[model samples]
Target: MPEPKEIGHQIKFPNTLMGLFKKGWWEIPEIMASSCLGLLGIGLGFIAVLNYVKNDGDNREYKKVYMIMRPDDPRVPRLKNPVYTQYKG
Candidate 1:
């Protein structure tokens, strides 16, 4: 029977700075694609978070001010025996 060949070829690491640059040229496209995709993901995530904050944040702030300024307004529901008032200081 024929003997099995060695599992894999050895990767050659460059010893000099110029050799390193030359060896790494093949990986430039792969690196650039990964960087672009990462930036795109971050930008989309930022836009989503900003949109949520703008919409929800404005509504929350308006409700808070309305409740404070017009507690007796017909739109505001009246609470009997509020939780905060029940607590003895």
Candidate 2:
């Protein structure tokens, strides 16, 4: 290994690259590839989080079941509403 003073007063490369070289993160292309991939992942995660929060998250309006029928269809009998019975156990 060469002494720090032997190199020069200023580093030839960026600190990030130098630190990466020290950590051997550039052993293969995967780390470099992941750097780009990580940015993509961060973008996707941001979009997802934005969408969830945009609609007010868990407190957002939720649609319930509704009967779907056209005016052209034959008239149907009114369905009996199920009575809510209290459990007496």
Q: Show where candidate 1 strays beyond 4 Å.
A: 1-27, 57-89
Candidate 1: C-alpha lDDT: 0.61
Candidate 2 local lDDT, 46-88, one digit each (tens): 9999999875554412337645445354522222332234659
Per-residue lDDT, model 2, residue 29, is: 70
RMSD of 2: 12.6
- Tens digits of per-residue lDDT, candidate 1, 8-63, equal 67567678987676556645867756877999999999999899886553444223
Worst 10 residues of 1 by lDDT: 76-85
Listed per candidate, the RMSD to the true structure in angstroms reads 12.5, 12.6
The C-alpha TM-scores of every prediction are 0.36, 0.34
Q: Can you tell me which runs of candidate 2 are displaced by over 4 Å?
A: 1-28, 60-89
